[model samples]
Target: MSADIEVVPSTNRKNAFRRRGLLAAAVAVAVLARVFMFDHQSLDYIAFIKRWYDFIAANGGFGALKHSFSDYNVPYLYLLAALTHTPIPVLAGVKIISVAFDLVLAFFVYRIVALRRPGGWLPPVAALVVLLLPTVATNSALWGQADAIYAAFSLGGIYFVLRRRPWLACVFFGLALAFKLQAVFVFPLLLVLALRKWLPWRALPVVPAVVLLLDVPALLAGAPLKQLLSIYVQQAGSYQALSLRAPSIYQFFPAGADAAVIRPIGVAVTGLVVLGLVAAVVLRRATLNPARIVLMATVSAILVPFLLPSMHERYFYLGEVLTVVAACYLPRRLWYVPVLVQGAVFPAYLDVLFPKGMGKGGQPGMIIGQAPPGGVATPPPGGGRGPVIMGGGPGTSMYEPTLEYRILAALMALAVISVLCTAWREFRRS
Candidate 1:
């Protein structure tokens, strides 16, 4: 009996060591992959980020915050200002910041998966899956966008909520909202928890409070208080299109239809859909569990962007990441959830990054460049119109949906339904 006990411990130790080695290997590979993508200059970088870096560098670094240089919120701009003083090349530095958060995102993915699948290989492997996921890597490393920052915080919020740490969850959610309005994609999930009274009402105020606290530095730097607070409001009004090639429900709209007439209907429908999901959560509150909450969050992340107006292609970044976590929670049934969501979102990235078409004979090359006389181009006041269309003629909107996008729209719709149904079944399970 003593020999048997010793043998079991030895075997468990060997398994644990093997898992750690595999996880280390995964992180090394993920980092190397991102290093290769570090040099690719995306259109958003050329048109917006590069100019903002220069403006921050030229205008007393942090002092530039006072001026409305970028449409992005103060939190990200603060990073740019700090980067101005660093020796690292601005392009690489920007991606590195996001890459750090990419790892943070993966860590949270691992933690969340471990909550249910503890001491197994699946959790470490799930972290690897998140790091290598095409959109996750490209959004930060290739595109140099900060989607990963808000995404990391949002995932932290979800993880904390699952741990029943409401205050921490609120703080993370607030940090996410401070970085990007897209963070609201997960807000519905948090709201559902609040309604169920699982998340305390006192903790709810922490979110906006964290956002406001993060804004103080920029406010002190001379950024107008009113304009600073209204960044998201301004962003919403800046775009006129119903959908920015986001593979959302708007894909069904007729070409050249008046956005003014269609926008309100889309908003109202989105509100109704959100309320319906919230109502479902309320009705099934008794069956709620960590796994069910994860699925509900997945539905919110995907369905909101899938239904809302004026969404960008990358708006579903949160959904794509959460699908991986949801699938990890119930691998047998939810494995295809990430597959479908990633499949739908990846092509949209290609549409902007390799707009020349990644088709049978298409060559991947720069589609367009709009640099100023001697420096990177600056986007017009609100923000640059969505990324450039390589071969499309004059007046072409980058958000224009193709047949492929329409097909992906169906896939995204299916994903949202799949997750919602899974949550419903979870509620029904004995």
Candidate 2:
């Protein structure tokens, strides 16, 4: 009997360890898969990190870091500094940084979902689902952009604000701003919340504080204040086009549409939209619960991309994330929103990534300089405006508004309307 007891105890311990080991191995595989899977040596991989690495090599470490930037902000420069320290090739390091933030982004999505109703494995499951989301995967691993990095902070800021931790949320929002201007998609929501008294105005200074902290280092290290500020200013006119790969009403315009006309009108309309949202929140300040707040925030984030000029294919990234959060929060049939969004943007992503291999060339991450001056230099030949022409080959622009592209764009617009109308109805019922 004593011998049997000992054997049984040993077997149980072994099984426990085996389970733990297998779990660990699974995680390891996932990490490695992201790290090394799409290590295609592309030009962006060169411009983003390798070229920076070369600058560090030629200019002696951080000595030249201040003057080396094109349009990326200072927090990303800090990332570049840390990357320079690691011996892992600059390309892999860059992608790893984005991949790491991809997990952080998913975690924030989980928290957002869990805040509504915390019960069981829903949060973890949400995180995993977002982890494997197609855009999230491609942005970090395949395209190797830092969209997820700033996006994580932006999402965290929203989560904390919902949690009533305004200061921490502002810090995160600041980090998001310091990382990239795209965080603007979510920043205005905070402003609306503050104006509605959801957050204290005193908590707002953290935004500039965090921004100053990120910028001061470079400024002190010899980066010109004018040059640094001008980076964003220049971005406004960087591409004069009214639309890039973003499927929007801009798709209706002629190929060579004038952005001077579109930019001002888009700004006016975006202002009106934001004013309407702010008025709604302010007028209903009494009932502005988490549900209402999230709905408004989600709608605001989508509106910026949906209405803005010079928008890029990746611009809807925040919208996609917020839509997923809205779906979990509202838990209605939101497949339509994501399905339309991914459908509209996936072709553009393919064109950017596999331009030559697939014979479909579209815009790449020429973000800092990707905006066109006005209208496409080249529209689809003969301007076939039916639904979608089959041959959007190497020469065709993703912004060419093929028949299929227009159909997808229209679906995306309808989906946004559907989400907003549904949220409003639910808010009334609640």
Candidate 3:
């Protein structure tokens, strides 16, 4: 019997060691993949980020924050300012910042998975899956977008919320909101928790407080207080299009459809969806569980971006990650959610990264085609060259919903419905 116990201990040690080895190998592979992708200079980099970096460098690092140089929030601008002081190439430094958060995002995934499904290979595998996700990889390393930074904090918020740490959840979520307004995609999930009493209502103030608190540095550096607070407001009014290549309900409308009429309708529809989610939580608070929380988060992440106008293609980043976490939580039933979400979002990234100007034979550029009536492309904000239309002149509308985006919209709509039905069934069961 003693020998039997000794053998069991030895086997467990070997298994633990093996899991560690696998995780390390996965991390190394993920890092090397990002290294190869560091060379791609995305339009965002060339047009906006690089210029912003140079401006900060020329104007004396953090002191440059006082001027309205970029439309992005102060938190990210802080990163750009700090990058100016570093010797690393601006492109690589920006991508590296995102990659670091990509790992943090993956660690949170691992933690969330291990929280519910402990003592197994599934947790590390989930982390590996996140690091290797196509959008996650490209958003950071290839395109040099900071979606992962906000995404990492958002996931950290979700993990803490699941662990019943409401204050920490708010802090992390505040950090996310500080990075991007798109972080509001997950706000409804937090509201659901608050309504269900999983998180205390008072702790909610921590979110905006944290956002404001982080602005102190920029404020001290002479950045206008009002401007820092209203950055998101400016961002909201910056783009007039119904969709910025986002695979949303706007895709179902004609490219020439009047934005004035459609924009309000989209907002109203998104509001209704959010209200419906809140109602579900109120009606079935007892049914709330860790898996269900993830499912509802997945729903918010998908439905908000899918229904709202003025959304960018990468707005669905959280949805893609949450679907994976949802699948890990209930692999047998929800395993396909991640696949569908990724399918719906990944092509949009490809379309943006390799626009029509890049020439064909590689990634598709369905986002930029068929300029509006004027056939002129308006320069993107922050003073970069406007999107190049193959045959059209500048100052024209550069965005027209292509068949590919329409299909993506439909797929996302289907995902939203499928997840909603599943959530309803689970709530009813409880």
- RMSD values for the candidates in order, in angstroms, are 3.2, 7.3, 4.1
Q: How does each model score on TM-score? A: 0.93, 0.82, 0.92
> On a 0 to 100 scale, what is the lDDT of residue 144 in model 2?
80
Predicted model with the maximum TM-score: 1
lDDT of 3 by residue, 1-430 (tens): 9999999999999999998998898899999999999999887777678878998999999999999878888899999888888899898999999999999999999999998889898899898999999999999999999999999999999999999999999999999999999999989988888888899999999999999999999999999999898888878877767888777888898867888888888899889979987886788655677988888888889889988998888988998898888888878777887787788888888987886653233333322322346664334553322344433333345566778889988888877887888777777787
How many clashes in candidate 2? 8
Among all candidates shown, the one with the greatest lDDT: 1
For 198-304, candidate 1 gives per-residue lDDT tens digits of 89989999999999999899888988999899888888887777788798988878777789988999899999989987986687656568988888888889989
For candidate 2, write residues 219-289 as lDDT tens digits: 87788787777666655655655776677778777765666787889979988887786676566554667
Model 1 poorest ten-residue lDDT run:
358-367
> Which regions of candidate 1 deviate over 4 angstroms?
357-369, 372-378, 388-395
- lDDT for model 2 comes to 0.70
After superposition, which runs of candidate 3 have C-alpha atoms over 4 Å from their true positions?
358-395
Clashes of each: 0, 8, 5
